[model samples]
Target: MSANPLLAADCQDGCFFVDGRFVPADTTRDVTEPATGQRLGRCAIAGAEAMRSAIAGASAAQAAWAATPPRERAAVLLRAAQALQSHFDEGALAIARETGGIVPKGQHEMREAVVICQIAAGLPLQAQGQVLPSTPGRLSLATRVPHGVVGVISPFNFPLILGIRAVAPALALGNAVVLKPDPRTPVSGGTIMAEAFARAGLPAGLLQVLPGDAEAGEALVTDPRVPMIAFTGSPAVGRRIGELAGRHLKKVSLELGGANNLVVLDDADPDAAASAIAFGAWFHQGQICMASNRVLVHEAIAGAIRERLVGKATHLPVGDGASGQVALGPMIDARQLQRFDQIVKDTVEQGARLEAGGTHEGLCYKPTVLSGVKPGMRAFDEEPFGPLVNLVTFRSDEEAVTLANQSQGGLAAAVIGRDVARALAIGRRLNAGMVHINDQTVNDECTNPFGGPGLGGNGSAVGGPADIDEYTRWQWVTVKDAPPAFPF
Candidate 1:
């Protein structure tokens, strides 16, 4: 366990930042540590007035930020990355306690967050435009411009990293951002991020952190001044945000929930495949949107893969998040624990065999595996969003692909095989936006586009240089040798 207190003792009376200054809200919400169910700190829950102030502040700061050279804006992001690295120890411990991620995983995520900021900072140089062909003596150039004010709603699973992934690029692209962190694990992650930005010399109101529940989120997303929304969360909430953005004709980028699939071909090494799948299914207690919840194996290798996976699943240590030795940690809250229980019970009733796990104590649920899961089973169709893996067997590669594609979600998929050609071919047929061959789907790099297709996304891609492009708009400037013949 950490020698530091579960909650930041100084955080109880602290307020969020609006315009680079700490400001209190009309009300505050208590943030609880997931592991011990202890009240950690109080976060000011921004009311409508506070939300309006934040949006106004962002709108006011955007023009200047946009006018600032992209490289200069990117420099702030790089500095922020450096600041994050300098303070990683405290940040990692806070994230682990607040989000219930194991110490090692938390440290890794914090480091990745710093890397994301660095990559986002480099986006200015990466933002490229096209020189279109035009008539003689006419100079035509197209360049990307900022969207002004952006609102980002982040999830709890990766409180710091994913949030920074969106915020850094958005801010680096010259747009001011209003961040609504998940209420469950708010304090340390957002606080650390805000401090880093402040240290990087970000202008007042260029970045703001608002902590609250769904009401606060709705206030931020539905506000007309907030012209852009980048969200990462459940499908149900994604759809709701979509409807609101549609009504207002606002730009929105959504990375919603997923029921990712892992296909193990008969030709693959069973041990290697099982180990990879187990990690993908249980990492962060399978709370990740990219986690592989369905393992579809060729019938010929189903038995071998299942046995190996069962052994791996059973061996994972489940305990305190501060324990670096523990590979698994508790769910984010008791409500999630209950929901997971319901899904497991529903799947078992639908004829799926429980291979291992399914025991729950408070917010903790054991890493679970289920075999014989069919399309009709709840576990097969819905995203369990827990450390529960549904095993399905198929006779051929085509059938495995079909099974993987059966879900409404098309976030990500994985195929394990020795033959690169076979794996690539199978990966192509899968509906997910990203696929991995002979590796797990969790190996995401800052340079790779990480959004999904179908219900998993609203056709917007995050990460890579392309992401910086997404945060900005293009403007075509055409200069004629002589002003257009007439002022048509």
Candidate 2:
């Protein structure tokens, strides 16, 4: 058994936390540490009936939870934030062990998770609406009220923050949440939140943790009791959820895949551009949605940037994350690594030159770089969620923006240039949801709007103010001192 307190406390049962207690699942699946292929422990899988019960329980509990005083609700979230802070080391370890991220990456997620909780704590009491001037002797106002039950489906990558970003705000805004975490990182993604909230004395049935596969996610999406669905994953899956939620007449928020681009202007420093590109594409093995999948460089400096990128890629450390020294760890599973390798191989075969680091020992695929990658190549067109950098050169700023906008996803984009005004102008022309000047694309803050348009998201955002809009609906109320004269 692992000595990590969080892992040891709940992995043995691998059970769902329903009504604030452990409920054994019908099936148990072994959880593996991707870095070493060691069995961490087993976890319960939520079956159809389990999902049904969880949803029904959430539906039943919503009214009272919503009726709870907003200050009290905010206090609970504040306590949960403290609980997460108190369990920082164990939480970071759990994230690294389950998601195959380096120790620092796990630490980043923990920090963001704490910020998410803290920001959400204040959301309950935020000014959610406005009072309107009305006709004489009448009181009129519009206020935000919680959606009865929210169903959250979070991805395996960056599991802790992604899941909690939704769960905390939804519960704080007086809504019950039925969260379905991806099975791969169940401990970090699901039970960790349960333990934190339970420690905070959240009322029973306010939050249900159901870790399961696609079927369980579908159950959560389709259940009539769940009025709103917040999902983060692949575009294909998000599209399906959109359709299903539409048919069910449910509100859905989708944060999907991205083919993010980091543009390097001719005037940008080659060293600075190269460092940002390497970090953007290789951090966490390029598993995040905002990772730079395409690097567009001005042709005047493309060769210099390419050379520096190759040098950096060949030297990055790749190994197990538990050591806390590796730059890149294993992919989450063999299947993911295989998919990554195949994409790189196909991109090479399609005539892009493979410049450096394409081989793998076990699950750690080395950071791979390719030059002369164009729009038609799979590496340029698809979201390569791996440690592969595809480089495309453009002769002019117009061409760079054009090439970047050709992508179907508009999740995130960045431009690097010494001329801040020029870079900002280029950013303004780019058709992406989030843009950064003189930086890489992999940037997010808990209080800022995160998500983009097009295939990347459904025009929905997650963060401080966005959470309020996402978890609640507007209701207009009007009152009079006495009954009005009836025209009828």
lDDT tens per residue, model 1, 347-434: 9999999999989777778889999999988888888889987889999888887788887766888889889899899998887878
**Model 2 Cα lDDT, one tens digit per residue, 1-488:** 22435444554367898988778787989889998999987778987789999999888888998999889999999888887887788888888989999888888888888888888889878897889999999989999999999999999999998899999999999999998988888888888899889889999998999888878888998999899999999999999999999999999989997678899999999999999999999999999899998999999999999899889888888999868888899889999889889889998999999999889999998999999899788898888899988999999889988998997766889999999999999999887789999999999988898889887899889886688889999999999989989999
Cα-based lDDT for every prediction: 0.84, 0.89
RMSD to the true structure for each prediction, in A, is 2.4, 1.6
Report how far residue 381 has shifted in candidate 2, in Å.
0.7
Q: After superposition, how far is residue 305 of candidate 2 from its true place, in Å?
A: 0.9
State how far residue 297 of model 2 sits from its true place (Å): 0.4
Residue 191 error for model 2, in Å?
1.1
Which 10 successive residues of model 1 have the least lDDT summed?
1-10
